[model samples]
Target: MSQPVAPKKLRVRGMILTGGVAAITIVGTRRSNITQKKEVIQDAHYEVDMISTLETRRAGLMQARQQWERKAKALQERIDGNKLRTIPGIGGTNGATDGSASSGK
Candidate 1:
């Protein structure tokens, strides 16, 4: 009967070294990929926060602008009212009466 032969020591050592190198390479690649993904997530979060802050500032500015526009409109209306009151036969009876009294004199 033929006996089974064991593998040579040099071939066994070479195979172990190759397997160890392959494992280290795979682990290193995975760690690099995980780090890149974390960075991407952080960047996305920062962008979202920036956008939120800008939107809040814009909304506040718009509200302030609306208030200023309202105040300006009210002021313009008051000015127009004063102008009408000063003009003859436009808003006040005092102007008509004074004009008639002056014409009669």
Candidate 2:
């Protein structure tokens, strides 16, 4: 009887796995760096965009106050608007502005 042919070795599988792990490692490192840069603001979990928006809102509040004062007797009823500066943990409004941290132990 003729000898059976030997099974071929699938060596390409190892190379493929190595390539995939390298790609994942590069991508994960890049993503981690980007995420870390985003979280270095003064406020707790406040991104750069959030701080910019807060600045804009403060400017708007100043303009609103000016307008409100200009029309003192315009028959306006007393109403409390959410100034957003008082909301806890909302739009960079952390409960403790005294530099206290609440991060991982």
Candidate 3:
């Protein structure tokens, strides 16, 4: 009887194929990580811009509020001055300034 033919050894080819696949996987993973980092940076910049815009709007509103308060105070002072002018001896210490004291029974 003839000797059994030996089985072919495929170890070297299998190792090369595995190494190629591993290199591709490693490169793909690195690229994906870089993409994720870029997206995070962009999102952070967008949030900063939104906060800056809000601060600018808040400053404008505060200035408007202060201006309105000043106008309201000026108007109140004018009204108080007019009331003082219309009333005679209001807040005076003398008792005769009051009408009831001046009129004899």
Candidate closest to the true structure, highest lDDT: 1
CA displacement after TM-score superposition, residue 19 of candidate 3 (Å): 1.4
Candidate 1 lDDT over residue span 1-105, tens digit each? 233334466678889999999999999999999999999999999999999999999999999999999999999999989876655565546457455546554
Which candidate number maximizes TM-score? 1
TM-score of each: 0.68, 0.32, 0.67
lDDT (0 to 1) per candidate: 0.86, 0.68, 0.84
lDDT tens digits, residues 1-105, model 3?
233332223566678889999999999999999999999999999999999999999999999999999999999999999886845565565544656665555
lDDT of 2 by residue, 41-91 (tens): 444556667888999999999999988886763433222343423654444
The C-alpha RMSD in Å for every predicted model, in order, reads: 5.4, 28.5, 5.1
Please report, as a residue range, the 10-residue window in candidate 2 with the lowest summed lDDT: 1-10
lDDT agreement of model 3 with the native: 0.84
Candidate 1 vs candidate 3, lDDT winner: 1
lDDT (Cα) of model 2? 0.68
Relative to the true structure, candidate 1 reaches a TM of 0.68
Q: List the residue pairs that clash in candidate 1.
A: none
